[model samples]
Target: MTASGALDAPAASRPMPSLAAFTQRLRDRLIMQEDPATAAYDRIMRRLGISIGIAGIIVGGVELPEVAEQGRYAPAWWTVAAVVLAFGWYPIIAVVSAVSGPRAIRFVCGCAAMSFLGALASIPFGLKLHTVDATTVWPFRVTALAVTAAVLAWTSRVTVVYLLTAATSAALATVYTVSAVTPQHVTENFLRSAGLAALFVWCGTAATGAAARVDRESAIASRRAASQAAAHSRDRERARFAALIHDAVLSTLLEASRAGTKSDVLQRQAERTLEQLDECRGAQRDPDLLDARSAVLFLRAAVHEINPSIRFATRTWPGYDDLRMPVHSASTIAAALTEAVRNSLRHAAVPGREVRRTVTATVSAGSIRIVFTDDGAGFDLAAVSADRLGISMSILGRMRQLAGGSAFVESQRGEGTTVTLVWGGDGSR
Candidate 1:
């Protein structure tokens, strides 16, 4: 399907949105809500995280027992240690709560703190809980696994949290399970968690890499399209201007010169014709109208060549310099709209002995807007899928290559069609 038809089809079969979409949305919203001043928020978070980490180490040593053993029991100091952990954790939680972006950073912080504290407190792991039910520690294990999985899911970063959390959970679960502690189901769990975490990391990374590649390819395609269009327009302009010189000024001057019988009179007329030709040519050749004028000159010259009675009116497009857009962006906008004009002119009916066709070009911020309203009867743009596709794909496709910009056509029988094209962020000479 052409780019246009591709745009008009049903929406049900679209691919699932990418994980990158999550981060993009987060960042966009963050920028919108807090603006760039939120950079200070990140700095403050980092400082708080660091301070919290230092406090954990100091309090862990002070409140927890000096000796450590895991298999037999809980420490007399477990409550005191939990109290200290709660105090230190609150500041980091507050930082995370205020953060306006991807919670991947917060997840990492929480996981690291949980894993470190859980493992170290295991210094007295076996000291208490002589006969505990396996189901009792189940939540702890599950929470550990979930948090580790979440970190892997969100950030795709490899960390010791996975091993530390997994090990602690499995250890506690194994100690309490009624069976002979067969590695069968328990080992399977370890392998399963590892596998899931690995898959998430791989998928996230692969998706991110693919997205970047697509973006680069799109950018390259846009540049090439613009360059080809610009080159084509330039060539078309020269052809039309050459034709104009040949017909009006060049032919008149040549004919006058050939009539030497009225030599002085003819010579004066020839000189006047030559001067007029130069002035007209200079106006047509103004670089500001290079591509826009190309379309006008080419359309008018070609139509007139076919039939003198056919009148084509074209107004020179405004200079793009005022927009100050980047070159590729400008080129894409100009090229797409130029092609649309060509298509509109080509599609119009030419049955009459006398025909009047009008084409106008408008340039606005980073967009080359063109409307070719003609006297010819117009077709239902929506009904004609092929022609509609031509506009969307040829025109809109060009715009899409410019950061997914848009192109559309509005038409009515006996009225006319209007084609709109928009290019991204910048479009200027």
Candidate 2:
């Protein structure tokens, strides 16, 4: 890639990279490294845990007084035990069996067992409470129903059938308990319980469907990204290999074809072939390996296409020789500087005269900084509009995206401009 276009395309010719592509960029963006399925599941579990805790607290408090008053029949301790196990089950097991293959099945079975046995134990006591005081203690049972639904929604890797089955168990428990305790309003109580069960099942089904959609989309995006990345890598490698062949192998082969069998010519040709082989090997090394010197060389080569009138100068900090950096970072810095230098050549000029520019690089304890300065007419930053995105996007934007990197621009009319690109080892120097 050309130096100017490496980090960003010319804004005038093309729009900035789309958000999808920006987010999907290889090697530095975390989106490429994260699994969306895992993230979505974590969110689901967190929401489920929070909702369960809140529901348990509210319902348990509301039902506590009635359950406590009827201690002769519905012992307070047993009610507390059921509440603790019923509400706390999912939150505990969700964490413990988070990655377990049978977690969904276990959760479904557990919810059903809790609702059934809990209703059986408490319904008789609730009937006694109603007989004595006409008061109902169904909050604990209702809370169980709601929490079970939430648990089902959260851990629903199993088919919708499991949710339906749990909802059926909860409905039957509610109907049995309500019908046994309050025979006069059996229909109303049964409908309420069945409605709650149906509502929860519907909620669980909807949540499961939504989560499945997210997982599906994430999987598709990941596969597409991987396929595209592989294809792009192959294309880039092919181009680089072709360049190596043209620059070294082809030239040497052509010379060998033209030269007669003179000893000197043959000897030189053989030496060139060996050198070419070495270069090919070097090219195949880790592509990101780069040093300050090499970065400067790349910057020089990249700027060679600009007008020759504007002179380019580069210098390194003393005693900090051979500053090594990630190849990707080095390339980004080089590209940014190349753009800065070109901008200087194009805009940093007197009415009819060229100006000189300098690119200085300094290495410190854990960071590197490069500054491009030129003595040319500089425009006001505020006067620039959104459409003029070259410096804003191609240079500053790209630098900011690099890990622990930042870019700044300082310019005043007649005083010229200075664009600084700095990168540190842990995002700060």
Measured by TM-score, the strongest candidate is 2
Cα shift from native, residue 291, model 1 (Å): 5.4
Candidate 2 Cα outliers beyond 4 Å, as residue runs = 1-37, 64-116, 125-188, 202-233, 247-274, 281-429
> Model 2 scores what on Cα lDDT?
0.52
Screening candidate 2 with a backbone cut-off below 3 angstroms (N, C-alpha, C), the clashing residue pairs are: 288-327, 404-427
The clash number for model 2 is 2
Q: Find the number of clashing residue pairs for candidate 1.
A: 16
> What overall lDDT goes with each candidate model?
0.45, 0.52
| TM-score against native, each model | 0.40, 0.42
lDDT by residue (tens digit), candidate 1, 95-203: 4433433244466455554644464344334333324323223223233333333332243444345544555555555445323445475666566555664554454
Model 1: runs farther than 4 Å from truth?
1-73, 76-132, 135-180, 206-229, 244-429
